[model samples]
Target chain A: MGQRIQSLRAGALDVAPILLGVVPFGLIYGVAATEAGLGSLSAFLMSSIVFAGAAQLVIVDLLAQNAAWPVILVTALVINLRMAMYGASLAPHFAHWSPWWKRVGAYLVTDQAFAVSIIRYEKPMAELPKRWYYFGAAVALWLVWQCSTMTGIALGATIPASWELDFAVPLTFMALLVPSIKDRNSMLAALGAGVAAALTSTMIFKLGIITSALIGVLVGYFAEGSER
Target chain B: MIASQSTGVWLLLGAVGVGTYLIRYSFIGILGRAEVSERVQRLLRYVPPAALAALVVPGLLFRGDNPGLTIHNYRLLAGLLAATVAWKTRSILATIATGMSALWLLQWLF
Candidate 1:
C-alpha cells in the first residue's frame, strides 16, 4: 500500500508541470463554451463528461456554429480515435488489474496521462504497480481541468484571441513526438505521418489524423521488413 | 433544460460522451486478456510516433482554415525551431517556450 501511494505520487508529480500548460487551454475552453451559448452547468458538464481538451473544444466550436449533430459526433470521435491506440499500447502494463478497474482506467486515459504512464511502464521494472501512477496523472489532470474550465466560464470571453493559445497543443505534441522517433523505421513513420497529415488535412470530417497515423504505422512496419 | 441547451444539444452530449468512453475502453478492456501476436505488437508500439506526428504537423501547418505554408506562417517556422530544440535538448519546457516566443516575436515583427 505504501508503494502504491508512492507510485501514485510519482505519477502525479511527473504530470504536474504538464498540467500547467493544460490550464490555460482549459480556461480558454470555459470561455469558448460560454460564448457558444452553453450555460455554466452544461459547460461544466462538458468538461467533466468529455474530459477531453481538444474534443471538448471542437464540440463547443461546432455548437457555436450550430453544425449538424452527426457532424459534431463524427468529428469528435475521429479526434478521439487515438485514444484507442493509447489504450492498446498501455494494455500490457495493466494486464494484472481486474476488468472493472480497467474500465475505470480507460476513462482517465488522456494523452498526457498515457504519455507519462507508458514511459514509466515501458521501463523493465518488475511488479511496480503502475496503475496507481496512471491514476495519479489522470486524476490530477481531471481536477485541474474542471477547476480551470469553471474559472474560465466564470470569467467569460475575457481571454483574448490574440494570445493564439491554441498553438500550445501542437507545441506540446511536437515535444512529445521528437523523443518517440528513436529509430530509422520510426523516423520514416514520423515523416510519412507529417506529410500525409498535411496533404490530407482537407479531407472531410477531419479524417486526416487517423489516415496519416495508419499510413505511418504501415510505413514503419514495412520499412522494418525491408531492412531485414 | 440543462443549461438552456436544446434537447438536441443534450443528445449530442450523451452520444459523444458514450461514444468517447467506448473508444477509450475498447482495447484496454480486451487486449490484455487476449493473446497478442508480435506483428500486431510492433504496430501498437509505433502508435506514439505516428499519432503524435499526425497531430503536430497539421496544427502547425494550418491557421484555422487557411494553409499557412508560406514563410509568413509564423507557426510553421516556430514549430520547426521547436522541433530542433526538442531534438537537441529533449526538453518540453524549452520547446514550448521557444516555439511560443518565436511565434509571438515574428507576429509582432511582421
Candidate 2:
C-alpha cells in the first residue's frame, strides 16, 4: 500500500505541469463545442466520452457545418490514428498485466499520460510500481480534463459571440502543431499537409484534411528514409 | 441554443466513442507483446504535426464560410503571429494569448 501511494503520488506530481496546458485546451473545447451549436449536455458528454481533444473539436465543427456523419467519423478516426501507435508503444511494458488491468490501462491512455508514463517507465523499474505510476498520472489528467471541460461548458453560455471564442480552436491547434515541427522532415510534412488542406478546402465531405494528413505522413516517411 | 439533438448525432458520437476506445485499446489489450515495425513507428511520429497542420491551415487561411484567401483576413495575420510565438516560446498559453490578442486588435482597428 505504501509503495502504491508513493508511485501514485509521483505520477500525479509529474502530470501536474502537463495539466497546465490541458486545462486551457479543455476549456477552449467546451467553449468551442457550445459555440459550434452542440448542446451543453452533448458538449459535456462528448468530452467525457470522446476524451480526445483534437478529434472532439473537429467533430463539433463538422457537426455545426452539417457535414455528413461518415465524414465526421472518418475525419475523427484519422485524427486519432496516432493513439493506436501510442498503444503499441506502451504494449511491451504492460504485457505482463492481466487482461482486465490492461483494459483499464488502455482507457486511461492519453497523449499527456503516455508522454509522462513512458518517460518514467523507461528507467529500470518493477512492473507493479510502473503500472501504479501510470494509473496515477492517467487519473490526474482525467480529473483535470473532466473538470476543466465542465467549467468551460458552464461558462460557454455566458460568453458573448463577439469574443470570437471559436478562433481558439485553430489557435490551439497551431500551438500544438508548431512545437512538433522540430526537424526538416517534420517541417516538410507540415508544409505539405497544410498547403494540401488549404487548397482542398472546397472538397466535398471534408476529405481535404484527411488527404493532407496522409500526404504529410508519406512525405515525412520518405524524407526520413532518404536521410537514412 | 440547443442544437436539435438528432438521432444521427447520437449515433455518430457513439461510433466515435467506441472507435476511439478500440483504437486506444488495440495494442495494449490484444497485441501486448507484438512488436511494431520501425517503418510504422517512423510514420506515426509524423502524424502529430501533419494532422494538426491539416486542421489548422484551412482555418487560418479561410474567412467566414468562403474559402477565399485575402490580405484583410485578420485570422491569417493573427494566426501567423501566434505561430511565431509558438515557434519562439513553445508555450500553448503564450500562443493562444498572442493569437487572440492580435485578432481582437486587428478586428478593432480594421
Candidate 3:
C-alpha cells in the first residue's frame, strides 16, 4: 500500500508540468465547442466521455461545418489511431494486470499519461509498481482536463475572438510533433504527411487528414526498412 | 446556452467514444503479453509524427478564410518559430509561450 501511494505520487508529480500545457488546451476546447454551436451539455459530455483532446476538437470542427456523421467518425478515429500504438507499446508493462484494472487504465490513457508512464515503466526496476504510477499520472491528467474544460465552458464567449485562441490548437501540435522528430525516419514521416495535408487541404469532408496520415506512416515504415 | 443536439452529432459522438475506447484497449486487453510483430511495431512508431504533422500542417499553411499559403500568414511563421523552440528547448511550456507570443506580436506589428 505504501509502495502504491509512493508510485502514484511520483506519477502525478512527473506529469504536473505537462498538465500546465494541457490546461489551456482543455479550456480552448471548451470555448471552441461552444463557438461551434455544441450544446453545453453535449460539450461537457464529450469531454468526459471521449477524454481525447484532439479527437474531441476535431469532432467540434467537423460538426460545425455540418459534415456527415460518417466523415466525422472516420476523421476522429484517424486522429486517434495513435492510441492503438500507445496501447501496443505499453502492453508488455501492463500484461499481468487484472481485467478490471486494464479496463480502467485503458480508459484513462491519453498522450500525456502514456508518455510519462512509459518512461517510468522502461526503467530497469519498473516491474511491479508501474501500474500505480500509471494510474497516478492518468488520474492527474483526467482531473485537470475535466476542470479546465468546465472553466472554458463557463467563460464561454468572454474570452474574446481577438485573442485568436484558435491558434493554440496548431501550436500545441507543433510543440508535440517537433520533439518526436528525433530520427531521420520520423522527420520524413512528418514532412511527408505535412506536405500531403497541405496539398489536399481543400478536399471535401476533410478526408485529407486521413489520407496524409496514411501516406506519412507508410513513408516512415519504408524509410525505416531501408535503413536496416 | 444549450444548443439543441442533432442526431448526427449524437451519432458522431457515440461512434467516436466507442472507437477511441477500443483503440486504447486493443493491445492492453486482448493481446496481453503477446509480442506485436516487428513489422507492425515499425509502422506504429511513425503514428505520432504522421498524425500530428497531418493535423498541424493544414492549420498553419492554410487558413480557412484565406485558404492558401501566403506570406501574410502569421500562423505559419509563428508555428515555424515554435517548432524551432520545441527542437531547441524541448519544453512544452516554452514552445507554447514562444509560439503564442510570436503570433500575438506578428499580429500586432503586421
Candidate 4:
C-alpha cells in the first residue's frame, strides 16, 4: 500500500505533458459546448458529470439541433465504445486490484489517462507500480481536463470563432490515428470505417456514422484474429 | 425545440449526462463477472481509429446536407490530402497547416 501511494506520487510528476496535450482540445470542446447553446454552468456541469470530452461535445451539439433522445443516447454510446476497449486492455494490468479501486479507475478513464496508464502498465511488472501509476495518471488527466475546460468557458463569448481553431479537432484525430497504422489489417479497418461512414450518410440518417464505425472495428478484429 | 438559453436546454443537458453515464456503466457493470470474449477483445482494439475516422470523414467530405465529389469542394479534397501527408510525414503541424490552408485558399477562390 505504501509503495502504491509512492508510485502514484511519482507518476503524477510524469503527467505534465499529457495535461498540456489535453488543454487545447478541452478548451475547444468548452468553446463548442457554449456555442451549441449550453450556458456556462451547463457547460461546466457537463464536463464534470460526463468527464468525457468527445461524448460531451457530441451530446451538446445534438441537443442544439434538438435531436431525438434515442438518437442522442446511441450517439453517446457509439462514441464511447472505445472506453470499453480501453478497459479491456487495462484488465490484465489491473487484475490484482480490488474491485472498488478498479471501478474508480474505470470512472476516470479518458484517452490521455488510458495512454499513460497502459504505457506504465506494459513496463516491467516487477519494477512498476500499476495501482499508483493509474491513480496518478487518471487524477492528473481528470484535473487538467476540468481546469482547462473551465478556463475555456470563462473566456467564452469573447473568444472569436474566427480563430477557426475548431479544425484542430479533426487534426488531432489524424495525429492519433496515423501512429497506429503500422499494418495492413489496421489500414483496412480505417479505410472500411471511413468508406462505410460515407456511404451510410446516404441512408438511414445519422445512424450510419455509428454503424460504419462499428462495422469497421469488427472487420479489423476478425482480420487480426484470422491472421494470427 | 428548446432555445439555447431556455430551461429546456438545461433539461436536455441533464438527459445527456444521464445517458452518457448509463453507457459507461453498462460495460463496467455488466462485464464484472463475464470476461470479454477473445473475439470481442480483439475487436475492441480497432474501435478508436476506425470510429474517429468515421466521425471525421463525413464532416470533411460533405457540406451542410450535400455529399458530392467536386473540385469546388476542395476543403474535403485538401483534408484527405493533408491526412495522407500526415500519414506519411507524421507531422501534426504540417498536416493542420496544409489542410486549413487548403480550405482557406479554396474558400477565397470559389
lDDT of each: 0.80, 0.87, 0.84, 0.70
- As a whole number from 0 to 100, the lDDT of residue B96 in candidate 1 is 79
| Tens-digit per-residue lDDT, A1-228, candidate 3 | 899999899999999999998887888789888777887788888987889988887777666566656777887887887888899988888888889999999999899999998887767745557888899999999999999998888877687878877777777777778877879999999999999999988788778888898899999999988887
The top-ranked prediction according to TM-score is 2
Write one digit per residue (lDDT tens) for candidate 1, span A51-142: 88877876776566555578678767766766877887878787788888888998999988998888888776555567788888999989
List of clashing residue pairs for candidate 3: none
- What does the i-RMS of model 1 come to? 4.5
Query: Candidate 4 on B17-102: residue-level lDDT in tens?
Result: 66555545445554654577877767767877787777677767663533456665665776777888788877656666677787
> Where does model 4 exceed 4 Å of error?
A1-5, A64-66, A125-128, A161-163, A202-205, A225-228, B1-34, B65-67, B88-98, B105-110
Question: Each model's fnat?
Answer: 0.69, 0.79, 0.77, 0.45
Q: How well is candidate 1 docked (DockQ)?
A: 0.50
Please state the error at residue A29 of candidate 4 in Å: 0.6
Question: For each candidate, what TM-score against the reference?
Answer: 0.74, 0.96, 0.92, 0.82
Which lDDT tens digits does candidate 4 get at residues A1-228? Answer: 788788888678777665765786677677766666677887887786778877776665556556665666677767777777777667666666677776677778777777777777666755347777878878988888889889877775676765554555566556556766668887888888989977886544367667888888877877887887
Q: Where's the lowest-lDDT run of ten residues in candidate 2 chain A?
A: A60-69
Model 2 lDDT per residue over A3-61, tens place: 99999999999999889999999899888877877877878888767889889988987
Off by over 4 Å in 2: B1-3, B65-68
lDDT-based ranking, best first?
Answer: 2, 3, 1, 4
Query: Chain B TM-score for each model?
Result: 0.69, 0.87, 0.83, 0.63
Residue-wise lDDT of candidate 2 within B36-102, one digit each (tens)? 7887789989998899999999888763653357777889889999999999998888999999999
For model 2, the docking class works out as medium
